[model samples]
Target: MVGAWIWNRNKERVETCSAKAVVLATGGAAKVYQYTTNPDVSSGDGIAMAWRAGCRVANLEFNQFHPTALYHPQARNFLLTEALRGEGAHLKRPDGTRFMPDFDERGELAPRDIVARAIDHEMKRLGVDCMFLDISHKPEAFVRQHFPMIYEKLLGLGIDLTKDPVPVVPAAHYTCGGVMVDDNGRTDVDGLYAIGEVSYTGLHGANRMASNSLLECLVYGWSAAEDITRRLPLAQKVATLPAWDESQVEIPDELVEIPDELVVIQHNWHELRLLMWDYVGLCAPPAGWSAPCGALPCSNRSWMSITPASASRIICWNCAIWCRWRSLSYAARCCVRRAAVCIIPSTIRSRCLTAARRYSRPWLT
Candidate 1:
């Protein structure tokens, strides 16, 4: 909100897509984990922005954790896609022991929830930093062909997929829960829509079935398109939105604390990340899981005025607060965060999609 105007935003507006529509292509709640494949800018900002504007949000929990993200101390963020397992892969213990069997009968072939929870359980029991995924038993050609991206990145990081096991662990990766929407991407409110990872369509069930993430996007985006095109003909033209406000506020005019120190920002950011990973992870809500573990944000500006001399100090403080909040925002859905899974079987899929479809579209519009 503090930067919404600077970011070319404040309130949302209706839009004309190829015809008339919008899709909140915001990805998943993965960054809530310490290790993830999502770009750093992701923070469930789209979801919150939508909700604050009056869209009904849903199933804010039920995040999906990936079972095999690369876990070397130097390579924790790179995801080893399930496609690797689809081709041929094994989850091995730190000591070169194959342990997936003890967790699930299907082993690497089990659905993501089962596999990720298994990895989490193993990591805890073995007291190891992370487990490993081995594709080394496969021929070099096969390994290279199916996972060229993984192969190249690992090779650069000094781990060869054809010879050594890749360090792997479960990282929060997807939100099986999200603002509820329909197959048509309609939420409770009219003229709104949602799609992609942020919307929970029933197809994923309690745990996501493999390869359905992208498929859901395509399927429902099409549905949203049809619904929107049909509505455009009947939609009315509205008046222009108001210009931004500045008559009451002035730019800062000083520079006492603008050295641009990012250390505090980064440290708090990482701390918020690990908090989420440790608190809410795989196997769905394990006993006493809260919404997400994260830090509250505060800046010196909260204690000072936005003036020229104070601006620099405020900016630095603002940056630090933002760094903290953005990471925490990843796991925060709509409210202050209910801190519970809180989904009923009969309502799980429908309510989430309903919330997403009827309301989430306005964020990007």
Candidate 2:
């Protein structure tokens, strides 16, 4: 890898950074989904950037939705830790009945994927907005002692963690697949190493076990560091690189313009998020996979046509999100096709596809 073209948000200009090696430790693309526990910066920029630099990503279809995130109008992206369940919290309905045991013998102790699927199934089955995680039966002192931070946070939100059942829902938590990398965290592009949630090292398959992500980061980070150290002596430095040129760039007039373009950009961003949440979320059908494949091109075209030459940070973020969305759509399509040909029986495939069509949303049709 030579360098990267970076946007300087404060300076309001593009700049070039020369580097012999680039490491992408950016977190997952969970922010692509409407309901996610990830921060705003987790927009899949690293994975998109790696893809743009000729790296092959894999298993983008395997997103991990966490089973229980705090579900409240004001509590955006707040996650209720799995430790709550581990400490005997029960997954309950609004009517105060346990539901996890019906789905799995392990109940709340089931794996994250199964638990998330169960919660999603129950929500759709009952037409409910959210489920309840009840640990109210536990001693108040024990709850306070074990989870002081969560207790305090929930208390501040006007929900007592010790006395009341917490409203919860499944949320996009992790991107199990990303830019494909080797054991040493090297991507297809030379000198470009991707580690952490941004790299797909094939450790986490269809579902990632809780806390395994941290271990992957630790191991791969060390391996990459060692590999880079070994290769640094042999690497030849580039003496000169092209500087960023702003000639002929059209700057929008702040005095005359009303900043109406922002509305369009924001609309497109909203549409993109809605599209992913509706079509590419957990429990998506084959039709869901196909819908985004058809719709994303139109969205991309609309975004590109209106985007100015000198784009804002939000516009650049939208571009990264677009890349991530396109990659996800492509991966979803591939998963559907592969499942049809290789995984499912021919008779079962036909039945599944028929069911998918029958249950597909009206807008998707």
Among these predictions, the greatest lDDT belongs to 2
CA lDDT of 29 in candidate 2?
77
Which lDDT tens digits does candidate 1 get at residues 213-241?
88888889888988888887777653343
Candidate 1: stretches off by over 4 Å? 1-23, 72-76, 83-88, 105-111, 145-149, 246-265, 283-287, 290-330, 333-365
Q: What is the overall TM-score of model 1 with all chains considered together?
A: 0.70
- Tell me the lDDT of model 2 at 306: 28
Worst 10 residues of 2 by lDDT: 301-310
lDDT of 2 at 301: 41
Quick one: best TM-score, which candidate?
Answer: 2
Q: Estimate each model's TM-score.
A: 0.70, 0.80
Q: What would the TM-score be for candidate 2 when compared with the true structure?
A: 0.80
Query: Once superposed on the true structure, which residue ranges of model 2 sit more than 4 Å away at CA?
Result: 248-259, 302-309, 313-365
- Deviation from native of the Cα of residue 108 in model 1, angstroms: 4.4
lDDT of each residue in 1-365, candidate 2, tens digit only: 77777655467566789888889998877776667988767777787677756888776666788889999898786889999999999999999999988867899999876687678778878989889999999999999999999999999999999999999989988888888999999999999999999889999886688789999999999999999999988888754557766454444444124355445545655666666666666666665555565564233443332222234433343343334444343443433333334224345333223434443332124
